[model samples]
Target: MTAPLPPLVRLPLLALLIDAALVVLFVLIGRASHNEGLLGTLVTLWPFLAGLVGGWLMIRAWRAPFSIAWTGLAVWAATVVLGLLLRVASGQGVQLSFMIVTTIVLGVFLLGWRGVVLLVGRARVRRAALLATAKRMSTAG
Candidate 1:
């Protein structure tokens, strides 16, 4: 058996990393053009942070089922919608196309990673089960 990781969470940590990366990207681009206003900062930070938290929740909720693709897609769509609504609330002029694209990319990556993780974990479990069965058969024989 593989040793357990530290008591610290793995998914949320991953989520934070993703959030930070995206936020930095947005900040850099905004700063480049001097468009990094308070509204822009809010728009960029809110979605990214929310995405991280949402991704963490989705992973935790569906970790057992391990269906990354669909769950990731769902969470992505939901979070994007949530983010856009937030933007609307803040009176930011957001375009629908932008939201769609953002949702697609984020959903695929966030959920896709989880799906891959689930696949690897499942494979490991299956391998372990097969090994145990083989051992049992050998001893029985």
Candidate 2:
């Protein structure tokens, strides 16, 4: 198996890699032009966390390949609504378009990555089952 890539590099590698990529991407974009403040930072981070939660629910649900993607979009919408409520309570009308776009971007990135990991795991299991069955049949024959 060519040394098996160590324990840390085998399982959970995709999620870790995707998270690092998202962090770098968001930090760069948010900090660009030196105009991003605490609220801007929060806006970027909020949907990423939402995506993680949605992806987790997807894994639990385990119904379809697109489940995670749909869940992520739903979570992004909920975050926008929550942000709007906050803006209203604070006496500032919500910024709809910007929040929607940014949250969707973050949500899709995180959720998509997690979905890929789950799919890969499922595929591996299926392949193993098939191989086991084939081996048993061959030996019996």
lDDT of each: 0.61, 0.56
Which has the greatest lDDT? 1
Candidate 1: 10-residue stretch with minimal lDDT: 61-70
Q: List candidate 1 stretches off by more than 4 Å.
A: 1-42, 47-74
lDDT of 1 at 105: 64
Q: Candidate 1, residues 5-80: lDDT per residue as tens digits?
A: 5535565455446544654554455445656687666656675556546654765633432355555555556566
Per-residue lDDT, model 2, residue 82, is 53
Residue lDDT tens for model 2, 21-74: 664476457557567687766665554445444443545322332345554455
Pick by TM-score: which candidate is best?
1
lDDT of 2 at 33: 58
TM-score of each: 0.57, 0.48
Clashing pairs in 1: none
Query: Given candidate 1, what's the lDDT at residue 25?
Result: 55
Q: Which ranges in model 2 have alpha carbons more than 4 Å from their true place?
A: 1-28, 35-74, 91-96
